[model samples]
Target: MTRVRRGVVAVVVLLSVVLAATPSTVAASSVTDQLIRRLNRQLLYMAVPIAVLVEIILIYTLWRFRGNDEPRPTRENRQLEITWTVATALVLLFVGTASFHALAHPSVSTIDGESSDVPDDAVEVDVTAEQWEYAFEYPDAGVATNETLVLPENRSIYLSITAEDVVHSVHVPELGLKQDAIPGETNLLRTELTGTGEYRLYCAELCGVGHSGMLSTVEVVSEDEYEAWLEDQRAGEADNESATDATNESSGGDEP
Candidate 1:
């Protein structure tokens, strides 16, 4: 077989092996995740074919004129050049369009300035990151927790993320969400929960010695359950405040 024929055969065999190893489908839990996965697959498909074609052309050119003592100057083909130029432009346009579609999504991008675009009914939570831990506060509910981030399923969420110390990042792979927490600056991350489940949260940036231990859980619960939990927390906070006030009064009376 000629060298060009061997190269063609090799390319075919390699493609077959890769196709067989690739999974038919990958499951995604959220719409944003699905969009990202689709974009990745599209890029992969385009890249593989382009790489293979380039390699085949390189191999053929190398082997076809191996023993030529005097090589003639190559003639330019305007038609081929124009065809490839147009093709390249179209490919770049497609990539830019697809990327913009994904990036414009509220769940994928951060909000700037006033959050007028944010839904009025969206749950608002302030996320504070320190050296070794994260704190979640629900301003509307007047509840705060450092253990877990509790969110309501099937509802839009707006998280105002900031850092108390060094820079940190909140990453939730399952939700396809990541936002940086910078000191004195708050970034808004918006997303809608689709189901009730526990997702792992991690600090993607290395902040300090305990960076590895900065882990938490995001718990998505039903609307009713979330309301009940918030009520319980409020009541507990009220009782604590009352007890502290009574103790202070008793100490003052004894002092006089």
Candidate 2:
């Protein structure tokens, strides 16, 4: 019995140490990851102790209390059983309580109420999805093109997304934002970047044959760079508008 208890302790300790070294990388992408880790720890804390206790009891009953030549009357320890059962229930209760706390948490939702999570100083971007292509439209910056989105750090962003013909979902794993773009209904996503870097975005649903091509990049840039780029796009847009107006005037004058 003693040897068995020692072995169980050693195994549990080794398992815990090994597990402490690795946390799921895919899970860390969301804010809820912290909740998941905490819940896991709580459950482990309860399970490890109970499992060791059970192993000790079983080994002790088998080796120390067994009679080789005499028959023994069976006796029940109701109090002991109830005590361990209640303790286990209490531990599970703690885990359940923690999970409830996470579920009750209010994540960044643009569904209703005051959606001021996206800072007022944010640069608005409209993302339109069609077939298998992605088009990013920065109205405030006078930029509309089928390319990656560059954002400024420490700024909140509001994405008003929609689809032209079918339904699609825009998913950014790093930002933990995914929203559906229905053909008739528009969806909004609000997010902020704390660190400056690049991230990948993908379409969550399989829409059509080229659904795999529904991918994009998000580049986080400095505030100064974002403002300068916005200026360049505005200048270029003005030039295009002037050429279009000149062509329209020439065509109208020659029509009749």
Highest TM-score model number: 1
Worst 10 residues of 2 by lDDT: 106-115
TM-score, per-candidate, Cα-based: 0.83, 0.66
As for candidate 1, its clashing pairs are none
Q: How does model 1 fare in lDDT?
A: 0.85
Q: Which portions of model 2 show Cα errors greater than 4 Å?
A: 1-17, 24-119, 139-142, 249-256
- Candidate lDDT values, in order: 0.85, 0.73
Candidate 1 vs. truth: CA RMSD? 3.1
> What is the lDDT, from 0 to 100, of the residue 168 in candidate 1?
99
Per-residue lDDT tens digits for candidate 1, residues 133-201, read: 999999988899899999998888899999999999989998888899999889998888777889999
Q: Model 2's lDDT to the true fold?
A: 0.73
